[model samples]
Target: MLGDDRGQSNLDFLFGISVFLLTFLYAVTFIPGMFTPYQPGAIDLSAVAYRTSAMLAEDPGWCNSTAAGGLPGNSSWEDHQDCLLRIGLAGDRGHPNILSLNKIKALESLVASDYTLVREKMGLNGSIIYDINVAVEMNGTSLINAPWPSASSQNIESIERVVLIDTGKELFVDCNNPGEQYNSNMLNVTLNNLTSRDRDITIRIYNLTAAYPIGLAQDPIRVVSLSGNAISLPPDDYIIKLNGEVKNSTDFGFMKGDVLEITILNTAISDPIISAVNIWANSSCMPGRPVDYVYDPVFKQKSVCYPGIMRVEVWSYAFS
Candidate 1:
C-alpha cells in the first residue's frame, strides 16, 4: 500500500513549492552580487574633492586669452577673462606642491566673475553641486582668502597641502650707485671677490617697466671684459653651457623692468679671479636705476620664496 502511494497530495505539493521558493530567496541573500554596476554619480564626492585638490596643488595651469598675448606666463590675473584652461597654483611642472601667487590671484578673480563658470572649468556640474574654498598663508601672512558660499550642508571634505609660493619679485641689480653715474663708454659690474671665476656667466637685461615688461628696449648693448674685450652671443634664444669653456648668448633682448640673469659654472675657467663686468649700451638705457625711492638689495638676483599653505574644501548635500 505504501509503494502504491507514490503521488503527493495537493496540500503537500503546495507546501513543498513554498519551501523551495523560500530556500532560493535565502540563498540569494548569502550569494555575492555579480551584475551590479558601480555608480560614481551616487558616491563621488570624495573623489571630486581629491581631484580638485590635486589640480590646484600639483598642476600648472594655462591661459589663452587675447589680453594674455597667448603667453600664460606673461599674463597677470587682471589681464585675461575666461581664458584660463586649468586652475592650478603650481608655478611649473618641475616644482610640484609649489604655488604661484599670480595664479592664485587669477583664480580668485575668476571666482568673483562667475562661480558657475569656475565650477565648469573644474569639471563640476549640477548633479555634483559643490563649494570650493582656498586659503594661502605666506610668511605668516594671508595672501588669499577665497571663501565658499554660505551653505548649511553638513557634508564637507577638505585637503591641506604644504607648498612654496613664488612671488616673482623683480631682481634689482644696481650696475651703478646713486648720485654717481657711469658714462656711455661702459657700465662696470664689480664682482668684489669673484669666487666663481672658472664658470660660465650669464647676465639677462630687461628694459621695460616692471608692470609691463613686454616692449624691448632698442638699446645697443655689448658685454665686454675688464680689458675692453667683447663676448660673442648666440644667434638665437638658447642657453649657454660650458664644456671646460665659457660659452654665452649675447642676445640679452632686455625690455624695461625685465630681468637679466648671469650664471657662471665652476668648470669653465682655470682659476678664480677678481674681474670687472663691463657693459656697453646706449646712453638712454644706462646702468642707473630709472625709478628710485625703492630701497632693497640691488646686487641680489633671485626669485623670492615664501612659505605657503593650500587648503581645498569640497562639499555636497547628502540628500542630493
Candidate 2:
C-alpha cells in the first residue's frame, strides 16, 4: 500500500508554500484599509486640487456674448460676458500656463464681489460645498490675494504653478521673443520709471526692403519721446545702422529681411518717479503699407504686469 507513495515532492511543497505567502500578504494589505477610518477612495481633496488647478492654468475659459453669435464663445471673456460658461485664468488655448492680466483682474474682482458665483463658475456646484482659495504672486508682488480659511480643515490640498503673464505691452524686443512677427512694421512699447540717468532705446524697423522712412510728418514711426515726457529728438538724435552702414537719416529708406536698428539715448527725467509711459501709434501698421506707429494699447490706464506664481488650494473637513 505504501509502495511508491513519496509524501509530497519538493516542487509541490514549494508551490503550496508560495500560495500561502501570497494570500497572507494580500490579507495584510487589504485588511487594514477595510478597518481604517480614512480610506483612499472615500474622499480625496488632493485630486480635486490638482484637477482644478490644471483647468485654471491650462485652459482659457469662454464667455458667451450670445448663443446667436454663431461663435460658441471667445477666450477674451474678461471683457465681454453675457453668460459665464467657466472661469479660467489662462491667456489663450494657443499658449498655456500664461495668465492674461485682464482675466486675472476679472477673477479677482469676481471673487471679491461674488464668492458663490465664482464657485459656480468653476464647476464646483454640489450639495457639499467646497472652500477654495486662489492667490497669484507676480514678480514677488501679490497680484491676486485671497486668504485661506482660518479654521483648520481635516483634508487640505495646495498646488502652485509657475506661469508667465501676457501683459500685451511689448517693452523690450530682443528679436527672439515668442510670438514676435518679423515682418511687423509697427512697434509699440511702454517704458516705466525712466531714470534720470541716460536711457537707451532700440527699435528694429523690420521688412523695409523698399526702405520707407519711419518719420513721416503726420504719422511718424520714429517717435523720440512720449506724451508729457520732455523728450524731443530729431532723426539725428538716433544712431541708425543698417547692413553694417551707419546713417543718421534713412533718406534712401530701409531694406528687407535685414533690419534697421535705431538707438536713441534719453536724458534723465526729474526727481519724481514717473508712474507710467505711453506712445501713440497709427492704427494701420501692417507690412506692405506706408504706415507704422507705436503707442500704449491702454492709453488712459497703466497696465503693469509681470511673471507670477499662481497658487490654488482646496480644503474640506474629513468625516469622522
Candidate 3:
C-alpha cells in the first residue's frame, strides 16, 4: 500500500490542485452582480440603495396612459397618484441625473403624507420588506428629508449620487436695455416661440412715464393682446401687476418709473405659442396706428438643471 502512493505522483497532485484553483477562480470571475445588482431586489441593501437612486435620478417616470381617466406618460405623477407606475424626478425623458424641481416638490408632499405608499412604489416592499429613506441636498440645504426606518434594524446601507434639478430659471427682459423704452408707451412681449409647459415668465417695462401725467386720460393704459391674441380677456390665464400689485385689465394707472409686470400663468394654458402680453395703446391711447414693439429675437427659454447630492438609505425590518 505504501508503494502504491507512487500512483499519484507529485506532478499529478500539482496538476490536479492547479486545475481546481483555475476552475474556482473562473467561477468567481464570471459571476455577475458582485458590484451592480440590476434586478429590483438585490442580495444586500447597498446595491438596492444604488439602484433606487439610479431609478429616481435617471427615470422621468410614467403614469398609466391607457387606464380609465389616465394621464399622459410625461404628466406629473403627483397629479395622478392612482395611476402612478413609478416616481421619478428627471423632467425630460431623454436626460438622466437631471431632476425636475416640480417633481422634487411633489416628492416632498408624498414622503410626508404617504410614506408607506412611497416605500411600496420604490420596490422596497418586496418579499424581504425593506425600508428606505431618501435625502436630497443642494449646497448643504436639505430639499427632501424622509423619515428613517425602524429603530430596531441593526444593518443599514446608504448610497449617494450627484444630480441636477430644473428650477426654471427666471426669464427677465431688462426694460432699461432699450433706450426708447423711456419714451415708448407700448412694448410687445412676443411669446410666439415658447415651448416649455411650465414656465413663469415675467416681462418688465420700466419708465412708461411721459412728460406730463396721463392717468388713463391722455393714454388709457390697457393690456391690448392678452397672451399675444387680440381681445383675450379674463385674468385667469395671465396676471397684470401695476407696480407689484395685482390689477385687472381695465385698471389703467400709468406712472413715472412704472414697472408693468406681466406674469403669464403657464400651467393654466396649453401650447401657448402666441405672444404672452402685448402692451399696446388702446384707441384712446393711440389712434389710427398699431403701437407694437416686439423684441427682435424672442427669448428661447431652455431647461437647465441645478446640481445637488441625493442620498438613499435602506434597511430591513427587524421583527422580534
Candidate 4:
C-alpha cells in the first residue's frame, strides 16, 4: 500500500511540471505582441485646418494671372511711369526704387489727382510740372513694338495726357538760371557760368526727394555766385545751402558759358553722399514727342530721347 502511494505522487509531480513549462512558453511568445502599441489612424484636426487656410489665403488675382505672362499695355505703362517718378523724386531723400507696385500706384494716383485740381484752379500755363517720371520696359527692350494707338502704343501721344506737358523725362525744377555757392550742414556746392545765353538749359539731380528736402519749400532753392550767375537747385544731398539758404552764401552763382563744378564734402557725423550729375536742355525743337521712356538693362542706363530732344545722364563719386 505504501509503494502504490509513492507511484501516484510521482505521476502527479510530472504532470504539474509539464503544465508549468507550457504556460511559461506561451506567455513568452504572446506577451510582447500584447504590450506593443499601434499607430492611430485618426485625422489631425490642426493639420487639416492649416492646409485649408493656406490655400484660401493665396491672392486670387495673382493666381489667376500668374500663367498669363506680361502686364497689359496700360498696366505696364502705369507701373513704369510710377516707378520712374518715384526714382526721380528720390533726391536728397531715401531710396526710391525699394517701394512695391501697390504703394507706388497709390502715390501716383494721389499726386495726379491733386495736381490736376491745382493746375485748373491756378490756370498754370504750358504744363503743370511734376517732381518725378515713371518709365517701363517690355520683353527686355524699351522700344514699344505695338502699333501706334494700340493698347501698347510706343508713341506718347496715343496715351492719355494726364500731365499736360509730355516729356519722356519729367522736369522738376524750372528755374531760369542757377548760381555757384551753396552750403549745407555737411558740405558746400557751387555752380558757375549760367546765364540767359545758356538757352533753357536744365540740370537734373535724380533721387532728390529721397534725400533731405522733401517738398518745394525745401527745394527750388536758389544760389547766387559772385559773378551774378544764378542756378536753381532741387534739394539734393550733394548740394548744401549755407545758413540753410542759398541766398546767404557768397561762393554761389552762375556765369554764362562756363563749366559748373559741383563739389561735395563730408561732415563729422555723416559721410559724403553724391549722385550722378545730369545736365541737359529743358526742351528742344525736336519734332517727335518724348516716347514713354523705359530702362535698358542691356545698355546699363535709362532710355535715350529721340533726335533733337533732351538726353538724361548719370554721374557718381565717392567721398574721402
TM-score, per-candidate, Cα-based: 0.47, 0.49, 0.54, 0.16
Best by lDDT: 3
Residues 66-162 of candidate 1: C-alpha lDDT, one tens digit per residue: 5534543532323445565556678777788878777777777777767777776676655656777767788677876554476467777777878
Candidate with the larger lDDT of 1 and 4: 1
- Which has the higher lDDT value, candidate number 3 or candidate number 4? 3
**Which residue ranges in model 3 land beyond 4 Å of their true spot?**
1-42, 66-72, 145-152, 169-297, 318-320
- Ranked by TM-score from best down, the candidates are 3, 2, 1, 4
Error of 3 at 282 (Å): 21
- Candidate 3 weakest ten by summed lDDT: 284-293
RMSD of each candidate relative to the true structure: 17.7, 12.4, 10.9, 24.7
173-224 per-residue lDDT for model 2 (tens digits): 3333333333543444434533332344455544432343343222233332
Number of the candidate with higher TM-score, 1 or 3: 3
Alpha carbon lDDT of residue 171, candidate 2? 31
In model 3, which residue pairs have backbone atoms overlapping below 3 Å?
191-275
Q: Model 3 lDDT vs. the true structure? A: 0.62
